[model samples]
Target: MMTTALSPEHSGDETPKVKDYSPTSYITHSNFEFCGYSLKIARTLSASLGVSAYVWEAGIALCRYFEKEKISFAGKKVIELGSGTGIVGILAALLGGNVTITDKPTILEQIKNNVSTNIPPACRHRLKVRPLTWGQDHTNFPTDYDFILGSDIVYSLVSQPSLIETLRHLSNQGATIYLSSEFRTGNGSLPFHEVLLPDYFNCQVVDRLMGKDITVYKMTKISTDPADGL
Candidate 1:
């Protein structure tokens, strides 16, 4: 079945866990040179199947968009839905956006642990974490956000509908959603989103060469509202 949101049960338990670590001792990617900063990929994705520990491509573009476009995340409310490893969401809060870094409760602890480790202390004052699953409806949210971000979130066809629906529901009027993805030749899951996105959004792809094995695409949400516009 096609879905666009996830139930809070996806977050697992409410056990609050937070720990700190040093990247110097961790086995992570050596360098991700983009957006004027070097992001580390850390590990090949162990969270789910087929997904590798590849660093976020379009995410790097979104970071560049923040810096080059002089995008102000400072004091703005932000959410990173389906944030895997949450590099971009952490970046948003670090840069001054009042950020909510959410994922399945399953990964929520990992998100917090990563936040403690990754956020450069200089900007750590502005970020927080939450449990959010797309496609599963809920009434909990800040009610409005100046920006909502997702990066490389598509991995299944069912997720596309949930993602689109979640984006529509969570977005405020005139709010902007910055999503990024790369075209995969025949992953069965790659092109799934391309067709579905146009239904609820005027999607645009921003392309650029990132590395030897990556091409990034950014999808901007042009217009939408809750209730699926359905």
Candidate 2:
């Protein structure tokens, strides 16, 4: 729809470290196959107000949702946590279900455009894009969601705890939380996620391959968290 776009593969993040709000471009791939129907969706960044967002690798990740349709999504109110490109969780919504997308304040607008571009005109009403900073007040988040998701978000020591905290705060009484991440060494390269999450939610590891060495961990959160015994 828009001419602005990013690369399918990031050679390097040229995004400047600016504190002001503006539009930026994000690019990700979305490949969908239905019987003989194959479609590739490309997402571009659209910034307005102060939010910056883009659609990500929805086509590839959508395969995961198809594989794990039972747990990934189905008749659920879904919220995507730390949506870098917002592709992974947005596809879940496009498939059918209520979807809310969240990201840092800096990326708010990008999340909006990505979500908007992917949905049909009618289904556009079903999606919600909001600003969500980890460990911060989530004023508009519903009390419960059938599923919560995060993708490629745990890349720093500064963000892990806040992400988990946001996960816990938004998760409802028996909700399942799914976090997809690639392992990268950062200051948070300690026993961080291993220890903190168990305190509030039971974590289930769903392993998946991300290209090669990069692993996308499909972490599930249980309602009955038994941390004392662990």
Candidate 3:
């Protein structure tokens, strides 16, 4: 429960930019404890698979937010996009949600390993890892999710469009969406705002206590058309 303001000079990015590492071999560990539940998870700390394998500050901020708000995930269907290291999704499953943590195909096994390693046997059935390439159609993925979670996903402008589209496709009507990102970055939040505007999602900045200047956005899909039934 520390409120460290993030600066560009010291963003606390744990994963060093390595030229290359075998995705199957280079492993790193991340641990979390929330609401009387504790977990230790691991990931392949290499960017070789087009995925990050370390815990980001934005993600830690999210875990803190959930802890502070006492957000309950019991019986809720949730999907976490860009679930790097799968910490947040694992936490949700621990809170009683049927959660799916997703990333690119290359890093799925690592994510699965993290889930298998962290989730308890009783809750293991609720946590799953799926391969998801942002900006692509997710018709094959689960829909009607009650909540959608993403952390530090807005850094890349090129991927924002596809990310927005995928969110639109997967989100159920009136679903609550939470997105967290670092403050004072070059990307800021322009791309997310511009894309989400046409989609009619009511977005707000919820002030939460977190390390650095990580901004957590609370979004809810507004049903503008009555014909769009659940």
Candidate closest to the true structure, highest lDDT: 3
TM-score of each: 0.68, 0.68, 0.82
From the highest lDDT down, the ranking of the candidates is: 3, 1, 2
What tens-digit string does per-residue lDDT give for candidate 3 at 1-230? 32332332222323333333563546544345666766665656444754366667788788778888899999999999988778789888988999989988877777787788778898888888888897664777866899999988887767777877788888877688998887545774655664654466878878544346668888887786868765
TM-score, cand. 2 vs. native: 0.68
C-alpha displacement of 185 in model 3, angstroms? Answer: 3.1
In every candidate, how many clashes are there? 18, 8, 5
Which candidate comes out best when scored by TM-score?
A: 3
Give the worst 10-residue stretch by lDDT in candidate 2.
1-10
Residue-wise C-alpha lDDT for candidate 2, range 110-176, written one tens digit per residue: 5565565666789877788787777776655776788777655565777777766677678766676
lDDT of every model, 2 decimals: 0.59, 0.56, 0.73
